[model samples]
Target: MFECFLEIAFEAEVLTEEHPELQELARQLVHEDPATRPAAIQELRDMIYERGECAPRRMDDAFLLRFLRARRFVVPRAHKQLVRYCRFLEQYPELYRDVDLWGLARVGCAYEGCMLDRPGVGRVTILRFGTWNPDDYPVEELVKVGMAMMEIGLRSPKMQVLGGTVIVDMAGITMKHVATLTPTIAYQIVCLMGLAIPCVMHSCHIVNYNWLLNTFFFLFKRFIPKKAWKMIHFHGHDLESLHQLVDPECLPPRYGGTCRHHATIGTWFNKIRKYRDESFDRDMKEFGWVIKE
Candidate 1:
């Protein structure tokens, strides 16, 4: 299964009728019927106009589709999520401040966006947060890094449809790191991922867990919803167990995988920047994240 995907070559593009495989997958997973897509999108658009509280920056088919797919083509639910998303971003002005590729890399979280062979897992995002230093890197900046990665990854129609898996490596996490997660920050992070983001969160795999990580999760469990909670799997130092859900061939050596490509922050950011279009800058404007050349 792993080798089968390696030959396909990942080419990021917006969802279209040309991609029958992905379209079929979207239909099966998210109840997206092409014949009814325009109607659904318009219905959500109408709701947006009716509410008048959360108007999208751009009301194109692509942009609205993200919210629609996240809610499984349910227009009302998608409209609600969009409202929440806009409200959340408007509320948290600080999370988007002073964020860029350099600052994010210094936070010590490496992110890699790659196509996967597995069904239901279109893209794999490997987030290594063990090297994070609370003293030097604030939790807010870390959140910015996450938002940046997600924004970049979601540009791919494949990711929007098949959804993606988040691998959280907590190997070098310490008590100090755990302490930085204030109750407010915890709730915000939960809302950003679980509620506001118009991306399909298939599942999250937390590996290399420990007591300190447990302490952080104690605060997290309160803010996290039960539905999202069910998608999370904890693997305390068991790479083999992690491999059961995710194909190790896509992972690096650190996670007991044979892949040689390291998902360093610089590499990830650089690639996204190179591949990013104008929307990348436009999207970050709300958070004041300007991509400097």
Candidate 2:
């Protein structure tokens, strides 16, 4: 059951990036045929409810106890990236200590938009953490990836470019309000899709991607108009968590309602060994983080 949830979560993340509109479609599908879609939706809702109530200390522990006896391994590319990133951190610990790996990756995505070097391709804004040091992560690598993505966006005639950077302190915000403020803050910082600007929040730590994404999606789908375009807040939580949380069912399954899916316990643990070791290796090799031998 947990494994199923993880699969659903992963699918959601992939769909969010590849076909965001599918989220809306999925919701509509549920509404269009409650008998089928709602069943799936209920499954997701049940899972989160249990998760919140149980509050497993770590996703890995939950996975190990509930799923397969052993855990899975990491993909080669992810391994390489993890090793490289770690090496960079070790080489420049002072700068990278507080730098969020996930945040850097997300910033890399935004940078992609800027590099497109096209007209009206949208803006790239960085919300500054007053105390953060750029040296922590591979800022150069981030700049490189951001530029590459931007170049891709520029090639598209339909997408224009408007770019800038914004730095703001995020110390006072409550966890509950994080989702609501994310897009609102982005809109304040940059000129997004003309309806509601698209923005990503680069934060150091987050409680749970499922909870956060669920909250953001609910608010986004409900209050924001149909024409408005805004991405849910992005904190570089574990990639696996992001994958798990992206499911349409993870949200309230229906707009003004609660979820009904059963929590997939121990599913994440099945892949922890692979994710951790591979992530470490990828950080060291690809991002140049130092490996502690």
Candidate 3:
């Protein structure tokens, strides 16, 4: 009975409450108190109904939990975040138009690894942003693809409680790629990550960067908050530095690691597709993702 217009779902295996370990993590990280959880959710629901502005398609516990956990069970902050999320989707119709996995994968630049299961690590997302060619896929499409991946990751309760770690591979970036990220685009992306999205960003590791990439990051740095700025760690081709923060055993060989289970666009697409709900397509149609048969 999860009626999410956002079209995101928790992973199938971990969807149930059978895993007490994750439930404990939720209590520790997100302050999910068993006694007060019901009251908080009801307060959020009442706030949403009172405002009636940009409310989600459904206000079920499952959907509201994402926001609640993100805001550390603060009813008012969660409600505000929910509104911001809904408004972001409504405002950016053009960016999400025709955003499909098959079409985006065909661009040959959306490289992402799997959600790592190492005990100490959260969900690690490896985004090879430098490999993207602006000619093939514009910045708007890049945002669309990144947003899609994040939306998929949000379905995991583990991802919500444990939060996320991002590695931005800046190996093949050029002025052409940097120039494509206009100030407007940078501002919008910053806002999406900072406000609209409910996911907790634990850390962001940037590898293989150069002066060109530094210039590129400067565009986004001004838009980023002081607290969020501290989360970004820059490593210009120094994999060892990245290893100190992110476990080297979890990374792939190209990033100076020993793991080979990294996900290509096609493999990751198929893997998540297996766990995707039947209603995903119907719910995502508004974002212009029509599955071609």
Candidate 4:
């Protein structure tokens, strides 16, 4: 199969503070009254057990809470969402088919990076929009790989429970790249992050963006939900200012942080690529079609 290289630092001391709401949700999922529990929750559980399908190691009350909270604990809607999540895995292998893919799809980690996790802010993510090389990868591949990155992040323990922050570096972007930000991609990204993936995006920082893209970005904002719209922040080119939000210690050298090795983006790419094929092969065996029986 494929591979995965990133090693999550599970140091208990590094974990900052607990997310009270999520802790309470975990409490409710286990201790709350069965009758008061939404019917859809039980139905989804029944369906999973009935199929005898094996869930991944991390699929616990925390995972169930994502769906429940997404639909606000409603029975029917939650049921539909649960079904959609499974079916999406079954059919949309190109996109939703990730559990089946080894390293979250064959997508490269060009535009995404994760490894920086802080306590209160959760998982610190980097979107190197400056690394966009359309010649190397097309739009379709971008969407699929991008979704894979999101899935990987959600699977992370801290991100799944405490939520996370995203840093979108806009340093090198121009009108040439704006074409890739199609309406379909924008809408799908919003829906994917908000619905399919359950991590709470606590904040999104836009650093080094040239003011010229404001009109385009403003138009792009219309397609996303108000919840996501509120999370986005523009920091322009000031890395020092950005450091106030994300500590310099958490960032790469280019951004004035450290990756324990080289601070350049190339090192970052090299780091994530190590797990590439291994993750793919193992995922297919673990979550693919035969397991459905």
Identify the runs in model 1 with alpha carbons over 4 angstroms from their true place: 1-21, 97-103, 108-118, 259-262, 278-287
Q: Write the per-residue lDDT of candidate 2 for residues 90-169, one digit (tens) a residue.
A: 43333333333333343321221111111111222222231233445433433323322222222221221122222122
Worst lDDT window (10 residues) for model 2?
64-73
Q: Write model 3 residue lDDT over 171-272, tens digit each, in one string.
A: 888888888888878877765564688877777888877888768888888888787878889888887888898887778778777665556655555645
lDDT of 4 by residue, 114-203 (tens): 455554455566666557677665655655655555554444434554466777777677776776777766655554555445555567
- Pairs in steric clash, model 3: 9-155, 10-155
Query: How many clashing residue pairs, candidate 4?
Result: 19
For residue 18, what is the lDDT in candidate 4? 45
Which order, best to worst by TM-score? 3, 1, 4, 2
TM-score: which is higher, 1 or 4?
1
Measured with C-alpha atoms, the lDDT of residue 255 in candidate 2 is 19
- lDDT-better candidate, 3 vs 4: 3
Runs in model 2 lying further than 4 Å from the true structure:
3-248, 252-283
Error of 1 at 233 (Å): 1.4
Against the unseen true structure, what C-alpha lDDT does each candidate score?
Answer: 0.71, 0.29, 0.71, 0.54
TM-scores of the models, in the order given: 0.84, 0.20, 0.85, 0.63
CA shift at 140, candidate 2, in angstroms?
18
